[model samples]
Target: MSTPALTLHGVGKRFGDVQALHDVDVTVESGTVHCILGENGAGKSTLCNLVFGGYPPDTGRIALGGKDFRPDSPAAAMAAGVAMVHQHFSLVTTMTVAENLLLTQHGLRLRRQDLTDRLDEIAQTYRLRVDLDQQVATMPVGARQKVEIVKALLRDPSLILLDEPTGVLDPAEIDALIDTCRAIAADGKAVVLVTHKLGEVARVADAATVLRRGTVAGGGRMSTTSIAQLLTAMVGRTAADLDPTVAATIGLDPADAVTHRVGAAPTSISGPDAAEPRSITTSKTSVPMGETGSTASALTRAPIVEHGAESVAPRVDNESGSAAAVLTVDRVTVHRADGSTALNDARLVVYPGEIVGIAGVEGNGQSELVAVLAGDTPVSGGTVTLADTDITTANPATRTGLGIGIVPEDRHRDAMVAEMTLAENLFLGRLGRFRRFGLLDKQAMGRAAKAELDRFDVRAAGPWVPMGSLSGGNQQKVVLARELSAANLRCLVAAQPTRGLDIGAVDFVLTQLRRAATAGCGVLVVSSEVPELLALCDRVFVAYRGALAGPVETSDPAAAQQISELMMGVAA
Candidate 1:
């Protein structure tokens, strides 16, 4: 038999007190896509980094083509025919695609024209086309991903590792990426895909390895191993043991018989006065999460059907227009620095005790709308009102003071300072509240932080630990804890709150939003995941070409089709 492209036997790694990877074993053969399946902080990324020479394994061995392999640096790994594309892109946003590609080449001097020609050839060969001269910042998420792939391809490596590459991609883009992966593997090169997305694995992977708590759980050929088996290994729980909502969210089989309680209202996860638990068999034809079609329809079907003596219905009359709105955006229009309208006459209202969702493909004015709502961008034409108080020109602090909480899309950049302690991050913008006289009351802040962390179920060493030390899920928990725990919070505008979270974390976030709504707080969620919106929101609106379309009721049988058409700008 031909030697495997790569192998890791008894590999282990550690960072500080955390054992990131332990006793892990994996093998990738040429001409195959090998998937690394795990939840966040399950050592998927750490395993890839070990192979890419980002860090040396604390123990055991890695072999390339049946030969012992050890590299001191990423450059050495590249020289040995290994390339990696990180979850967070490393491209220079200020530079053009061609310029970024050129930076990856090793030389004292090189011809830019030659590099451009080579890039064009590779693009044509792989069918991953992108404008060579377009600035990285100006390109869409899909285009930027293609650039990263092309950069990795340029190395002509024996093995290429992609870490959570579809976190931000739309459906079409995800399909395209799957095709690209097949093409790469067809060329007799090994592909290692590190992701928690089970659907992607089912579509593109030839074999998969499951990791849980930094140890090898299970793995096998895709044809023989069921997705349920893989999921069981990853989470250490069978599909039957999971809540039906969570099981569906993480792409379990539609036929799985699972039961969960329904609250007094269809809009909430569970009402504050919810009755005894009930069992209901879901539809056999229900669309699973991460599937390519009609997820909104699948999730919304029979959402609140009458069961015997219990009749689940809407308790909160948000659409009646009787209760005062917590947030109102009226004819909001925002222009980019280049004089182009980023948000065009967008208008929406979030009533107290309601959860509203904004859904669309990325770059369809969602970011601009979020910025406008966060008071980061000034609206060219609009009036934003909070509880009858007009605050169109209010700054971020003023908005926060007026009971508007924001959770930005890019958490690391816009939300929290990673280098700071968890305590500091919890009280980031509201340091004054924790101040004792003229000095900062760090002790009080730490105590409050600890309480919040425990309340939010954020798993971490301590409040004194750096915020960056926690996993993506834990970090998000901190952010949510901070925003939701605000004493004066009346409205929460969260953009992609569960963008990179695992299935468990997604459940937690959705539950938190529902609880907030139950407590009379208006919630606005912006997300690219249509199913998530349908599953959690009372009503969903699509953002299309800087315009708003449809307050489609989640219970509408045709809601998914309507949202899809609106997203494509085809709705009349």
Candidate 2:
């Protein structure tokens, strides 16, 4: 097949005591799309880093087109005809999209008009339309991803590495990306897509390689392997042999139903099947604790829903009660930086002991909605009330004071200070708790941080290490630990809480949210992954152009499908 584009033999990597990758081997042929699949922290990023020259491998060699290739840095990697689009965005939020696009291509001063024209052409060619002149900070999550992909394509590299590039894209956008990769391959370039989503791999990949704990466990043409086979190779287990206890604890039940609808209004939580034992009572406090404050480590046992169970039909709330809505949004509108509107007349309400889910395409103003709820952005026009208090104009700190918790979509950037030690970052919003006569109480903060780390079962070298030193999954736990610590939290706003987390971490986070809802805390969850929203939310709201569509019962798959269509702007 005309000399493989890239190859690795016995590649290994280590960071201090952590063996990130070990004895891995992989090969990519010319002009083909190769997909590498693995769970979070299964050494996928480590392998990519090694190939891109982020660091030298502890052992082994890399060859490009039958020649030895050792890139010392990302620049060198690009110079060797390799370009990569990272899963985590690295754009200058303050810069214009045109300016970011021009950053990669050199030799010509970027004129505003000229840059715009070029970006327009590129976007049209790839079906990735975006406002070239808009500030990235004001654009939606999907638009930012377009910028990243455009940046990589501008380089015209012979080999491209895309890391979970579709995590934030809509179905249409995903199709466009897959088409773009295929077009790249048609041009005789090699594409390596590293992702955890098996469905995407099955659709777009020509060949598949499964990685497990730092080694390539299986490799074959995509046509020869089924999704189940790929998954078995990735996790080293057969579907039938998967233990229910492990699946339940790690959040990997094969039968777990996801509740995302595409084109209809949000589904209701009421139906005969809705009475299932997911959560028996809405107000559940009195969480059981272990001796070491490590609740997560002791969660290996099967979960049991013990409170009063209801039927699966949607809950019809027509009450005129006086209990304050923990969160309230009135006629809010979100505008794009380029004068386009994202959401119009969008309203939201969250009461105690309730979980409200916002389901839609990746963009559709979900990120902005979360920001508005968290008080990070000013609503264009609307009133927001928290615990019967008007918090529409309040800042982040004020919202926090009103017992609001936020797990932002971008956990590494907006949620955690990665450069700081774990303990220091954990104590960030809890300054009052570590203060003693105006002095910082280091011991108290450490004790508190230790408790959270144990409770979340965050695996790291040590609590004293920088937060960035841990894996992606553990980094998410840090954000969750801090957000869920508000002693009297009336509401929680979690955006894509399990985006990059592993099964174990996903289970822990979902369980915590359920527990919070049971404890009279209203929770608002926004996610692109429908299954997650289905499993955790009490009711689902499909947002389209900033409007809430449904409030539909998830028990009926037909109704759920209708809602899914509505979410994607599809007509029934």
Q: Against the true structure, whose lDDT is highest?
A: 1
Estimate, for each residue in 104-177, the C-alpha lDDT of model 1 and write its tens digit.
65752547877667777776767777687899999998889999999888878999999999888877788788
Q: Write one digit per residue (lDDT tens) for candidate 2, span 375-459.
A: 7777778788888899888899888888889999988778888899999878786778788999988888777788889877787
For all predicted structures, in order, the TM-scores are 0.89, 0.75
Candidate 2, residue 453: the lDDT equals 93
| lDDT for each candidate structure | 0.79, 0.69
Worst 10 residues of 1 by lDDT: 260-269
lDDT of 2: 0.69
Native-to-model Cα distance after best TM-score fit, residue 525 in candidate 2, in Å: 0.6
Best candidate, TM-score: 1
Q: How far is candidate 2 from the true structure (C-alpha RMSD, Å)?
A: 10.2
